[model samples]
Target: MMLLDLFAVIAAAVLSVRGAPALTQDPQAAERPTAGVFVATDLNWGGDTLWIPDASNGSCIVLPAPFYQGTSSFGPDKGIACSLWYHDDCDSRNPSFGPLRTPGVSTQADWSNATYNPNSIDNNGIAPNSWDKQVTAFNCWNVGEDGLHID
Candidate 1:
C-alpha cells in the first residue's frame, strides 16, 4: 500500500509539471501578422468580419479594401473614409490595403486620401448612434468574448 501511494503521487507530479506549459499557452494565439486580403461588399457590411493572423510577418494585419467607407463615419456627407482597424500590435505596411477611389470619381481628380483610423475604440465611445441615415462600420476582429454586439 505504501509503494502504491508513492507511485501515484509521483505520477501526478510528473503529469502536472509536464502539462503546465500547454495549459498556460494561449489557445487562441494570433499567428504572426502578415499581408493578406479581405473584401467587404454592400451585402455583408452589417455582419461580422474575421481577422486571421498572417503567417509571414510577425506584426502586421492585412485589411480588406472596402473595410471602411467615408459615409460609415460621422454622417452620410462624409462618404466612406478609408480606414484600417486592428489590434495595437498590428503594423501597417501595405498601401494597397490602405485606401483608393470609390470607382465613379475620375482617376485624374485628386480626392481625399484614406486615413489610417485604428478601430481600437474604447468602451465609453460605443454608445448607440441616434442618426437614422448614418452607416456605422465596426471592427469585429480581435474582439474577445466579452465584446458588445451590434443589433
Candidate 2:
C-alpha cells in the first residue's frame, strides 16, 4: 500500500537524520584520547548530557565548550591535570565515587587534593576500559558543583 511505502521512506529519513558518531568498542583503540582529570572547571559536554554508572564505575566525558570551534580551552585558567580511577557508587572501596588510584594520596586531605582521571578511550563504551557500558537503564549521575571532573 502507498501508506506502507511512505512509512518506510519516513523511517529511513529519520534514521539518516539521527545518525551520530559511532562509539568505539575496543578500549585500547589508538584513536581514543588518553584519560585525564581536570580540576576547578565546570565541564561542558558539548551539549547537556548525563553520566551512566557502570558496575565497576561511572565513565563520561565533558567536551569543552565552543564545541564546534575545535578548541581545547577550558576554565578561566584551564583545568588542573590528575590521575584516573574507577569506583561504583556502592563500591566499598570508595563509596563517594572518586578517583581510586591517586599517587601520594592516602588520607582525606590527600584525596581532596588528588586528581581523578577517567578513561577517554572508554567514553563510547567500546574500549576494554569503558565505564558507562554497564550502567543500569534509566540510572545516571550528573556532574557536581565543586569536585573532580574528567574527560
Candidate 2, TM-score vs. the true structure? 0.20
Model 2: CA > 4 A from native: 20-115, 118-151
User: lDDT per prediction?
Assistant: 0.27, 0.27
Q: What is the model-wide C-alpha lDDT for candidate 2?
A: 0.27
Q: What shift in Å separates residue 75 of candidate 2 from its native position after superposition?
A: 26
Model 1 lDDT tens row, 48-99: 2233323222233333334333222210001121223222223333111123
24-129 per-residue lDDT for model 2 (tens digits):
2211122313223212111221222111113122333332332222211111111222212232222323212233321212233433443323323233332233
Clash pairs, candidate 2, are 24-126, 25-126, 25-127, 26-127, 27-127, 27-128, 83-117, 84-117
In model 1, where do residues sit more than 4 Å from their true spots?
19-89, 92-151
Instruction: Compare the candidates by TM-score and give the number of the best one.
Output: 2
The positional error of residue 112 in candidate 2, measured at the CA in angstroms, is: 14
Give all candidate RMSDs, comma-separated. 18.9, 16.1
